[model samples]
Target chain A: MSAPKPSDLAFVPFVSVENMMRLLHRIGIPDALTGLAAYIEEDFRRWELFDKTPRVAAHSSDGVIELMPTSDGTSYAFKYVNGHPKNTRDGLQTVTAFGLLAEVATGYPLLLSEMTLLTALRTAASSALVAKYLAPDGADTMALIGNGAQSEFQALAMKAVCGITHLRLYDIDPKATEKAMRNLAGHGFTLTACASVQEAVEGAQIITTCTADKQFATILTDNLVGAGVHINAIGGDCPGKTELHRDILSRADVFVEYPPQTRIEGEIQQMPEDFPVTEFWQVVTGTAAGRRNDRQITLFDGVGFATEDFSALRYIRDRLEGTGFYQELDLLADPDDPRDLFGMLQRANDGAA
Target chain B: MSAPKPSDLAFVPFVSVENMMRLLHRIGIPDALTGLAAYIEEDFRRWELFDKTPRVAAHSSDGVIELMPTSDGTSYAFKYVNGHPKNTRDGLQTVTAFGLLAEVATGYPLLLSEMTLLTALRTAASSALVAKYLAPDGADTMALIGNGAQSEFQALAMKAVCGITHLRLYDIDPKATEKAMRNLAGHGFTLTACASVQEAVEGAQIITTCTADKQFATILTDNLVGAGVHINAIGGDCPGKTELHRDILSRADVFVEYPPQTRIEGEIQQMPEDFPVTEFWQVVTGTAAGRRNDRQITLFDGVGFATEDFSALRYIRDRLEGTGFYQELDLLADPDDPRDLFGMLQRANDGAA
Candidate 1:
């Protein structure tokens, strides 16, 4: 009848990279990491409720782009992540991502946000949370191998969530370890710059392997890892991209986010299909053993999962109310009558023209 | 290394709904439709060059949400769309979509645009482009049944691409037909609002059945369709959502986009799995017959596919340069050294603080 005014439902909140940074700073990084850990832990406690599917991926010669989607019946979330190691040579991030949360009932997007930062945070939180269950009791020092983008977050998340306060960092490139040392400077960890991966693992109760190479090279050998150490393997995440030796995988008690996915993307992909591994959620739910003995090696084959992204999305959505950390995007066309889309466009032309 | 300065790659161009509408008005709807049809035709000509996947779907009790992804080697695109027919009763669109294009090499997003408008245009363009090949020669009038949201776009696309100058429209609801007629006014098409589907199909060489229901109700029976007519069957784009009677499909020469996807989502889903149908690209390539003789019943069972969205995205990317119809968004977190992600976030904190 008259010109259609846009309904409130037409707007979806978007958190840009700037807003994501501000949100992290506003909440403080340690607090954000702690908050994310809680969310991740809560989701893991009810893991069976999630609709988990292996990420849909498109692989190329240089990289892989993946879409990870999961729903908790009422809410749905998906993250678009691309890993291009060569991108850094062109001054781009090795990994960049964005994600959205939507109401499953209406299929309307509730929030769209930059996920590059969030993914880093969630990966760290997940590693530390798994370490909380799998790492030896009184675990304090963590040897963070491959001191790249994820190193400091892993160090700080371990401190915030798992009561780990000491760190030993190493990378094939010395500059990466230097970068991580500089970033984790203000954080409350006794940081160490190690000469080699062997030196980094010395006297460390936890070993975090997060190398950026897209190859199957061994960052950790079986002999280097002692009987009682917990391994948080983060970088060996894609097919043909693994960091630990198959010998290391054979001796350690491997735990994974989701078995079907980890078998394809985790370090344990080197193992046969029927090789034994425990679901990390099962350990969280007390249905499976985590750290079985003082001398037993616990390995969290930490390939990132969709449910963690879902949790991060839920956390961000919950924190968005009156935060001024988001902008409303007019992403959907809202006509006066749903069936009169053309009429709506015509009126806009008439009004604008 | 110095703190990371934001790179040009950090930003992605975003076209909002208002901007998309303005872009449509800037390049008149007919020209845009014609342009889209050209892009679709060009892509169809080299259809084998694109990497296609059947859309990934999440079905609910009432509707389904789908992700349709495709790549043309150099670039990639995916559309996020939802079909909730009952949404109209709440004054919401049954289908709302947005899509993104990315560099295949780096997996960096090149463009993020509202595809609600674009999908409408592309779907119509696809139907009309197919009609150009399949419709009987000298087809001047199209019977546009189900005068709803997509009706006007289909009518105009036919006029712009298929040389159809007259539209005979009908709907179950009188108000819908009135809305479509009102929107089509001032356009060049001679529009008639018919009281019934049979009346609308009378004397028309092309019939487009596009109704929005979640069931197998027949909008076109075997007796209603005459020989030598082309049928552009849209709207029956999900499981159990056929608009034509089974007997009509038995007699018509059904052509579809990507048989693997069409066999599950198109009107052909109503037929036996072994029922024969031609791939539409074969007809475009002249490997198969379109409208071989005047008495042949050619049906284009249009279940929206991913490559068409890729074509629309490519068209939008080509048009975005120098148009100033988009805004750059900091959707990606770019670091100076791609591996120093933590350093980038730490600097963001330092600068902002």
Candidate 2:
């Protein structure tokens, strides 16, 4: 066979949040969620193919900005994300992100995308995917404590992935719960707005806590957790920020994305350095057990990994192929004679002059 | 006065490369170059106020990808750049880049820009700024030994900033030299295309080497040395990539960007770990010696730092304020209610329904 031409190389397609929402609107959210979950699960099974590293974080007075980069030999990906919880007061999303996917062989960016919406979707999908293996059999009801921007996605993802039919929502802000209720109204799920975290967790099989505060507030104390409940800890995802109390984690069989990063940023940070935890990939690969027994409480200490972003990026790139919503950006220079980049500029100048 | 409300915070302007070029074309490249030099010098003077770190790199099979992040309390910036020398063979530029500037207090991305072109301009401006401080007085001739895409920019920046009026250019690829010659025509500078590196360096006050290769080949050996020549080593910017001979670096007074990074990626990478070098910021701040005398050879190992990109970004942001060429990218979510991000999707769904 002849050598593959440059044009034959895979080009990573980018999707802006607007374009992504449009695609989701066309494809419908449930289908998108299902597709993303499938992609994520397939990637997780190939655990050792990835080159993983703890995200490089730069801390400042107000919040933190991080670069989470990973590669699987064929492709490289990274997310540029920031967290400033106080941003909500200023009408800004507490988390904003953008990321790129590049071909590892050529180091050429294939996609440059707005990742804010995709991040929410992927985070929820990851939780639901893990819960498929870890959650108790026939789990239907989930307690969504700390209802916020991500609560609706979490609710829908659980419903679409793990057969969750009921959502017990509670939030310190009544408006947050109301917004979630309204958002999930016609999604074919029963929603009950509870008065307290205890009320929300009382009879639910799965508990998801996704608060947006940038602190170590224990949104789920040990006394509130029940037996056989699978806790999807989503929001407490940075150094000095946590949601589940140490006692709750101590009693649960904890699972994490990447142990090295989760130990520093996840709810598992409250545990000791030698605390035993399973990498979610191992469980996905069937190398480790997810839930030991029906009475055991399981915790997925989710801090969002680069691998998940890579999977989500690939999914979006594949899904948005013929969609016309994405604008062609001249993000890279494609000169007829690449070494004559100076000539390209000269041609532009000549045309103008 | 009462504290300004959160909603009253000013929106930062963004400038993409297409719009930045429009701004440059309107103001003229000469004026933009002058303005960029001023901004770079000003930022260098206040270097201590900024938080600086060596760029984080992810190496792959074909090339390397890197993230350069820095902040100055009020604003944070990071650039995602990749270098794939083999890319030129496939009709793509060897390097591609983009960056972001964000507000520190809220962690909101203020600007997202296409930096592929801006990087060339900024790298040239930074090298020239260093030459202005380190090159001896009355230096008006430059030897550009690598006549690739960046060679003309280097030549022009040196001419505009250091008053260099004559250029001797050489490249292994004769087409590249011809391209540089064409690009430099009518740019108010005298130029000569030479046959070899030695011919290019003959009797010149400054020498710039910017070859596009990812290896440790020594383009400049001790035999080509001359006194009082300021060497701007541009392309030896990654580990295992060095253009200058060890003896050249050993004898010359080397000025670098961040010392830790330069030690690993610059020409000094060939030297011992303890080799002493002065950071360019010190020379800009007048805290260290630049050139002791007219006969002293100096080398500005131009590895390209994040701070220079920060300066370029700020300059572009300021200059492109009124230009209508930029499209408002929906890169960040500005939810009416920050906690109701899911509601935005629901509303979109409702509108479609």
Candidate 3:
């Protein structure tokens, strides 16, 4: 009962893309989404305990790679994610991510997992969780603008977490909407493919904009949106990339993930620096108002905070205890003697030689 | 003519610690150290091309976990590392690291390797590389303080790159020095285990301090370090953890990795904010003086820069093409139709079901 063996420390559990997909299906995507939303909600409730900062971003000519790190006192997590709009044209996913969760006491990685699928899941889960507190009561229908890689996840997470049963989707390209329609086929929802944003939002109480253009172009103009509708804005996530007109933001009471980050990357970037906004966690903690009235437009401008990723990782880690969806990776070098790193190398040479 | 398949895109080559040791043995440790030094030298020569930022650190009651990220436009690399002083007491490594290298344009990781061994290799490479420029000519003996995990690597790198042939080691714990002596037994050099710091420094032209402590420390005093000698100060990396006294810094012209990071985390942290320091790259680029005279005391105040990690990763990546020491892990999610991430997951679920 003295100490754990050093070789036992070499293994860090890793969930690959294939394993992540199996885990998602095994738990059922709907149940997974709801479970993930619970974790997100729990973390949001104790948001003050987190170390929050704007993600460190490295911008390039065609894309950006970002490292989002956060920690509670007990655990630390960071996500390595990249966004390249042109990647689709080259037959690659626009986003591919991986993340690690570590023990804060030892700074050792406990889990390393492919985050591309998990990120899409968590980003949608975050929206659904926020919608629970901000969306108008009895909001059963959602209008999904921009049907792309994340559209189906967005639709299902909202259905499972926010009780939105009907899905109306629209995109500038008919093929994107057709693809999304096919993916969500027979998923227990009444799905509609609309021609324009106006047609998509016609009978919807919640509108979600997730366009992917890295520009200031507006997917939703002021005239197109009516009052009493909750907007879950997920597409405008980087500087100079926005989906809604400034006029809509002026009229709406905006809620964000983290202010310093969302101010630069969210739709509210078009607003004045001193513009008033409420952090969504404050609403979760019951300190801030959410959906003051049915007629009041509530906007959740989410850039996807690090804590949501941390929550998703924490959830996956807890779920991996008995599940066979993870592989123990030889990620860290643990010498038999703590100070004998070179001796470990020497032994490896002897074994290999 | 067609796009790469999704499975192919998901496979990222990973070199585990055992493979890293195999590669080092294949390349020979001295040559590996020299090869890594060349890459480090190359990167230091064009230091401005890199996007240099201080590491994002998360401090806890126990230790710190840091993400050091840097990009040179064509490629991006980041190292995840942690330092916990009490880890050794629990039979865990005090420092453990892993890193990834990616294509800057696509943001796809090309290689993921265990950097605990690589960092140890690269830190020694950096010291020896700097010693090539700053250490006295024909210097053959080095006094190694704190002969712990990094001691033997430092001694060998100095032998390979700086032409040092003799080593004098000292440690408060004789067991650490004994461990180093055993690890470096077959390596070709004259080894001397000294009793004290004064005994260790006698007739040595180079001095290396690589201790592991969490508080303010003076491993090297002012009068103990004389003129015409080069000092590679590594252990004094974190805030409040400095190896040399302020008087030693006052007498020596310190060259640091990155000024912003060094001013906060290096030995220079003990000096005033306005204290004069030179970036080591200027000397590499021949824009600044390295060893001005035989009487000058030069210090390479290296707090392990991100570029050195980048270079080590770059080197390991290039060396992995034909080496059978790498495993391709399914680390990314790539959908055939880039817009249909749900379709990919659905197919995976169907296959698994």
Candidate 4:
């Protein structure tokens, strides 16, 4: 075969939230989560190839906007996400995001997709991937605190990843719990709306805290957490915003993704500088222990990381190949002669002359 | 008029590279540069309203990929840009970029446009704006140290912003000088292609360094300096990159975009931590002195900041309003019912439901 023409080169495919939801429904949510989790693990194994940095955040009085970027030698990916805690009151999501994946060699965007829905899916997949190593064997019950837009995702991902069959949900708003219940209706999980955080955590094998608040509100107390229960903290992901009590973090065996970032954004921010924590990659690579003893409480301080988004984008791109589910965006120019950008414009002005 | 429905909300319009060039050609480059510079100056005056952050960058061995994001209270903007010094050898532009503007309240993307061309324009406009406040009286002759894709824009912006009439150009490649000469034709600038860097700098009151090499190469030395030259350093924008000799920085007064970022990425990176430098915004806001004496050498260490792009996006959005130059992007969803994101999938499945 001869060299491919510039136009023949594969442009990255994009799936909007509308199309992404359609893709998930058509492929089935469990299968999508399974595929995403597998990709996340594979990417983690070759972590040395990635250029990772802590996210750059712009803070405001109401919320924060963050740019999380990461790259392997061949591909680069970044996500634009914002957290506005008061958004739900105005009928908007507390978190909304979109991302781009590009070729590293040419610096061309291959895929641009709405990350709002994908973020929820990937965060849940990441949580469940960690729970597989940190949760107790044959874990089936999970306490999901804060049943908002992400609650159903966490419940479904845990079901697929850890075979969890029972969910005890708690939230400050009864309407949010009802929405989560309605959304998960026929998703094959036994749901219980708990009266308080303590009721939700009682006897659960795993606990996931994903409450959306911009302040340092303690959603999980040390008294509520039990031995051998793995806690997945997702929402406390910026400086001045945290969900877990400091005492809860002190007693648990902490695991994190990218220590420098976790030190600032994760629940571990409350602890001392020398706080002992295991990087999740080392545990996944079999270099460190995950759930050491049945009595030890394990915590996956899951402030969403760029590497997970990289893996999720890879999985979505691969799965959508030949599926015809995405549209081609003119994100990068394919000039007949790349040197003549001005010439390309002149031709475009003359109606694609 | 009644408030528009969420689905009918006006998108902040987009301008692609082709459309942007057409807009510039229609409005004329001088008018656009002058308008953009005005918008930048206005934004600099209200610097405290912006949610600003240092760019998030992923550096590879050969180049760098960066995401610069900023927001006013109403709109959010971000630009994705890449710089590969060796790209020209492969017939590619050294810099390529695109950006997005979004509505803050609804988290809806208002515009997506190619910024490879826009970045060149904005960088030059920002440099000219700084030189307006920092350069000596009636500055006309400018030394163009790198005659690459950015040289013509810098020349034109200086003409528009500071009434620069003469340009002395030099580059390692003679073909780059030829390209710049061709692009600057009919732009009303007296251009001289010099054989050496020293020859280019002779008697020039304003010097712009825009070399593409990603190294600590000193393009300007102490011996070449003049008494009142306003040096606009454009290419030494990332870590481990510097353009001016440390001796020159020690003697000249430096002005920067953001202090924390300038300390790491600008030519000032070669200086000590305690080295005194004034922020350009402070000078614009009259909080700091710019060019205290006519004989003082001043440097605008222009390692392009996010706010400039924010202003550029705002300016383009305003100009392209009635000019039918933008295409609507289906980047965000406006579901009839926000809660029915899952329902949208079912409708798509049913086809014309």
The CA-based lDDT of model 4 is what? 0.81
Candidate 1 residue lDDT tens string, B152-216: 99999999998999899999999989889888988888989999999999999999999989998
Give the clashing pairs for model 2: none
Docking class of 3: high
Worst 10 residues of 1 chain A by lDDT: A1-10
- Which lDDT values do the candidates have, in the order given? 0.89, 0.83, 0.91, 0.81
Q: What level of docking quality does candidate 2 show? A: medium
Better of 2 and 4 by DockQ: 2
Candidate 3 per-residue lDDT, tens place, B72-164, comes to 999999999999988999889989999999988888998999999999999999999999999988899999999888999999999999889
Over 4 Å off, model 2: A1-14, B1-17
Each candidate: RMSD: 3.0, 2.9, 1.8, 3.7
lDDT of 1: 0.89
* Weakest lDDT window of 10 consecutive positions for candidate 2 chain B: B1-10
- Arrange candidates by DockQ, descending: 3, 1, 2, 4
DockQ of 2: 0.61
lDDT of 4 by residue, A165-206 (tens): 999999998877887787777889999999999999987999
Q: Which 10 consecutive residues of model 4 chain A have the lowest summed lDDT?
A: A1-10
Candidate 3: misplaced stretches above 4 Å? Answer: A1-6, B1-7
